[model samples]
Target: MHRFLIPKELKILVETARRSCLKKPDLFRRGGYHRDLQEIRWLLDNVESWNAESRISSVSAYSILEAIVLFFDCLPDSLFPSQLYSTIMDASKSFKNSLEIYNCLPEINANVFVYLITFLKLVHSHSSENDTDLPLFADTFADVLIKPPAALSLSQIPKSDRDSKRKFLGYFLANDVSHLFQIDLLLTRDEYPLLARHLVRTGTN
Candidate 1:
């Protein structure tokens, strides 16, 4: 199901997430254009070209996923000041699709998925502290926490698998390299297996 990698639905989700990022005008410093954001916008706009194996390497697909996570991670906590809950809730719906397919994705993309989920959990936590009314992402947050991503299960990985083409989302989850990629800093107890697996992989390879 390589088609799952870059389908119309995935493209729409990226576009919607991009639009949500742009809605926060203060994301850019006064008088300075957000050149970095433009890169992500371009990626969203040219989804077809990037997904084309002949045009850009398929490795670039992970770039698209990483860029989406970075967009929200880089934003200030004050994003969508006036309508934070509604706007992020809408955006989270788009991201929830990624979460559903977390196991099917490649390494970097899967890491991005975990990071996004963590980000949403933090957002929901903050919102509920005062509002009492849970944010829209509450359900998604709960669902992900209950199952955790299959990618994060280090003990389940086979010992002899070494095909480079093999997707490593699960491997990444069981590893400690998330910090190297600027993913969320707070590692949960469930992520300890990830660190152990990462160490084993690094030593063996």
Candidate 2:
């Protein structure tokens, strides 16, 4: 199994998100979810690296996952169709393949799987109502790509488990270019701070 490492493409995505955030911090403050979307795109793009064994420090993982949720909560619809979506999806798939190589680490595997599942859910939720069988597509993607564990009910997982799941899923989802192109639901405040801290740490390191 290949270990996770931040990819060059994902680094570019993060830079774009940071630029967007700098360009309009107030937009994010005033409920502009687009800025948040950019940030999520960046985090998800690099989730595999963040979840990789060598990279599995709590601070780093939390920082990346927290950014994803925060950006998700704050992003607006106008950002859809941006090129960033395609980048996120491509990166996510690449990382997912790397993760599959090292499934022995249940903690990492579980967390990454949940993050991917969440991304699929977000995609399903965000797709246009007119789009045919979007939900079915999401389920199908999860079935084939994720194969969630029977012992792991997301709701029943502890905070650490939930955090790991979110982190992994965030990376997995970012690979789906469609996520970059649509808006489903905003992330909750409860999910923000943790990810934000992760973002800060990632930036510095």
Candidate 3:
């Protein structure tokens, strides 16, 4: 492939979680599957080929959400790579800094990063039924998406800076990163937009 396509698996998991969690009160409290590595692998492998609209009743919200979390875990270079961690933090409270940070990322990283943020923003918007507020969502994802330091024992990342990644992520969740990522979620568009279409908007923009 000329360019690494944003993994359809991530899209599949996001879409699956979106459907599984809708209108379900305290879905996080119900808690789907997070620890079952075997099950998570199965979900990723099986649904990787399935269309975004496709769904099965057996899949639980927690399982889908956990799968998404693991998706980030599987990344060799995090959504916010360690090299740019400082730049991202500097931009945390400034729109101009956010744009600069966006420009600094690789195309694939930028697109996938935006895609994920878009999906999570949608999830947060419906937090009323799911009991997932922006802070909770941001804090939950910070560990996965934000790479603290290559070596915690080494004197690389400062202690205070290490502790504040979640606050920065919460800032992003509360603001607009869509302008950075042009992709539009299917939920906002057609009744059942394909992942391809959901992502295709980036090309047009």
Candidate 4:
């Protein structure tokens, strides 16, 4: 598979988006999910600016995508109206569809892609009055990162980089999951036993 270059600026922009969503959950609340649509629209408009100057590695691209997933996962349901769910899901689907233009170098992490797709599909289609499954998506996200379903042997990624990537995932899952748990408890008072389990596992490691 051919590798696609990800610009440093684009990566930083994605991280910024994540931070905006997490650190300031209300940033997109004014317009609801449409605010997210605006963010995606802006990214699409700037897609042309993601040139090959000081391009990022393929692994970094995957990390950036993971951050995007985190960004969406962090979005609060209270801030988004029920009617906008489909719009948000459609926007996310379109964004993922755009990613298909560039082959994920060496190999695509099927686990990550599948988990994100499933999370989005469930959220987009759910009709229950109570949104009990909100934390489930966050838990599943942390699970996917901490223990990726399968690690494919890829020639493009060196052993050292692979090990580093694993370490990074572990670190991210450990800190991010705990932080998310606190946020959820404070914001929604939701119980997330999965988050607790992962935190213990992370602590043990």
Best by lDDT: 3
Q: Considering TM-score, where higher is better, how would the candidates rank from best to worst?
A: 3, 4, 1, 2
- lDDT on C-alpha atoms for all candidate structures: 0.31, 0.33, 0.59, 0.29
**lDDT (10s digit) by residue, model 1, range 24-123:** 2222112222443344445434555334222222223334333433333332221122222222222333334323344343443344445544433333
- In model 1, where do residues sit more than 4 Å from their true spots? 1-100, 129-135, 138-205
lDDT of 3 at 157: 60
**Cα misplacement distance, residue 155 of candidate 3 (Å):** 6.7
TM-score-better candidate, 2 vs 4:
4
Model 2 has an lDDT value of 0.33
lDDT of 4 by residue, 46-96 (tens): 444343212212223223334344433333221122233223323323334
- Candidate 2: misplaced stretches above 4 Å? 1-66, 69-102, 129-197, 201-205
lDDT of 3 by residue, 9-85 (tens): 66666666666666666644444443343454554554534633254335566656665666675565577777777
- For candidate 3, give the lDDT of residue 95: 56
* lDDT accuracy of residue 49 in candidate 1: 37
Task: Give the Å error, residue 78, model 2.
Answer: 29
Error of 4 at 23 (Å): 2.8
Better of 1 and 4 by TM-score: 4
CA RMSD for every model? 19.5, 18.7, 8.9, 20.7
